[model samples]
Target: MKRGWCFLLLWLLTPAWALAAELTGVRSRADAGNVRLVLDLSAPVKYKIFSLKNPYRLVVDIESTHTSKALSMPTTGMVKSVRAGKQQGGDLRVVFDLSSQVTPTSFLLKPQGAAGDRLVLDLGASTTPVKATTRSAGHQPQSKPKPQRSVVTRSVRDQPQRSVVIVIDPGHGGVDPGARGKNGVREKDVVLGISKELARLINKQPGMRAVLTRSDDRFIELSARRRMASKQHADLFLSIHANSFTNSKVRGSAVYALSQKGASSAAARALADKENAADLLGGVDLRGKPDLIKSVLMDLSQNATQESSLALAEKVLNGLSGVNKIHRNHVQTAGFVVLKSTSVPSVLVETAFISNPGEEKVLGSKKGQRKLASAIFKGVQDFVELDMALRLANAPSRPEISYEVRPGDTLSQVAQRYQVSLSRLRSVNSLRGDRLLVGKKLRIPTVAGI
Candidate 1:
């Protein structure tokens, strides 16, 4: 963490374009289950949106905005999913399309700090045959199906769409204080607070849900975290952590991916070792399993998912840069144990440095945490939007990378063969060990660390 003065100075030096821009409208539509966003801004806003290979998500960045009203988000026809709010002091959005072909509508309302202005929209109802989209214009169409709501005559599964499940992992809790600041603030607490906030925001949206790896203050094995996401059949995973440095003069946010074997830094490998060690805390044995097999599988899996993850990570990095300095402008890849969930796209977010006294105090503050969490939420939304756009525009799905299960194939051996870390392989394929079933299929996650 850097001094308060540095933050102040950075703010002073920021390009005037970023400081004064404001978000106005962001309308979305669904076409064949794909969602497309058209942002109506007061001015030409310069922004970027991409995905991170780890903790896969879509991220968006905009100059700034003062949203003071309830935003109009439709859940009707083409719009089967929607999420919108403030993040990092800017307008945040999250949306899911049951199919492509969406129509967008937008309007603005006056400012009201607490409730904000009312941006009203009616998502005409999806053209798909889902029960929720069957309502006629005679009645106010329900945005989505809530717990208390009744199911229409149509069955949800009949619509034929994949559910998107997101798992949130809050870093450093219980016995691990993680990084501690001179002001006595703990990184664990700050990240937990932000995670909870993000979960709350995600839960409020339709077609999206969140699960926390550890809901309470307790220690959890890193392997278990990945397993949790696998058990939940999650679509994405996110690990949250606060950073620290020997000198209390550095501050910024960062995101990381899994490293390819021989491509990871020594520091990243060490961190991976520590994180993987958490699995041993639960007493998982590893006396010579198929390490190479697991590695090969991850390489194949990542071949299909890496592009999206990288895009999302880049978007997040850009979005975070809008709110604060970035530890690294590019997305980094390492052998992080927590990110070893092979099925779900995963990423680790280092929110800020706790070693800096000023940053520590700010992070401990409710306002600071809220701001940080908001930025992240918005970045995720942006990533989602980009994905929807690609789908609607007929963008190609990632090509699946494949690996063969050879006789006597071990996880480590396979990993070494593919030049990917063993943990990374296990994560992508949801493998318990180096054990391989002959003639089985596997998805490899990474070819090298970036």
Candidate 2:
């Protein structure tokens, strides 16, 4: 009763401008082509934006507002630093120091579910892509004929087969640091390290390449991450994140595929809520934000894609189980915003628990991080092999090679030597086990490779 009376007195005595508006949160997101800065406020207000040169800076001034001391000041991607302070004339001033010149755009967003009013500012690279500077003396660069056969001919024959593209996203960047461990192990940094390692492994594998949604410690909206994967024509969209909880004892790896229905369990629902709240923290209001969400029409094509995502999630979960303790023996189902691609098969992987002291140490080390990455790569490789086998079964018969099993050779070794999936090799040879007797003849499928 005493605390309540004090609060009432304070509220009554406070100035209207200070009580009516507040600069509650400030965060930034690095998009594929630009960076977005959002200011969370208690109420909407008229704002002003201006630019500065000489080392490049952007200044935002909001009239009649107070700010939270905990308001985030992000330094990621090209953003050098951010600072918020009171301006003369009783205005709130937020300044962004930039690494280079950038164009700024601003918008006002009304309150959304579980979120309040926000002011959004977008920064784009001021310097555009440079074109060819040197030109031939005779003329500008001439266009080659479509059917040209010259050495410089732009043709499919000159292009090697495109490798399978896998887009790896390191979750919770920019303003959202994700869950923090007792020892200050940040989920964003740890997952970025793991994602980079996984990309390296994936690139080293023959006939595969990797693209990272974010290559540095920065924030990216979930929608932007998904759009990037789709734009790259990715075969797989694998989002990497580290889990955390109040109970440090809860720890392990988990895999999730998006569910059309509600989450499979209560915990899954709660986890989804935490993840979906990322946009709010980053200052992105999903309500009336059409640019972030393209469409919600789940057609037959999307259904087929979701099915494939689930199958791949299962394979990845199996692979994760081999390297680390499985949080769930089966692939969990959740409505993760990151896994909402209409064409790409997507999954979210919780590499480990950052909140757990033991797991945090393991994830902090390079060796342990690589081990986790390798485990994820194995799962992805399995999914790719299974997908290829399905395609091969439907594809017209390709030429086959026959080889006799050499002495001391195992089926797994043979599969590796031929650069083919173990499952496909087993299917073609009709082998039930890894054991192979000497001099056994096998029909090798050339579908995976020649």
Compared to the true structure, candidate 2 yields what TM-score?
Answer: 0.51
After best superposition, candidate 2 residue 192: deviation in angstroms? Answer: 0.3
In order of appearance, the predictions have TM-scores of: 0.51, 0.51
Candidate 2 segments whose C-alpha is farther than 4 A from its true place: 1-161, 287-301, 389-450
* Per-residue lDDT of model 2, residues 132-241, tens digit only: 11111121122321211111101111123435668898999878999998998888888989998998898687666677888776778878887777655566889998
Error of 1 at 84 (Å): 20
Candidate 1, run of 10 with poorest lDDT:
132-141
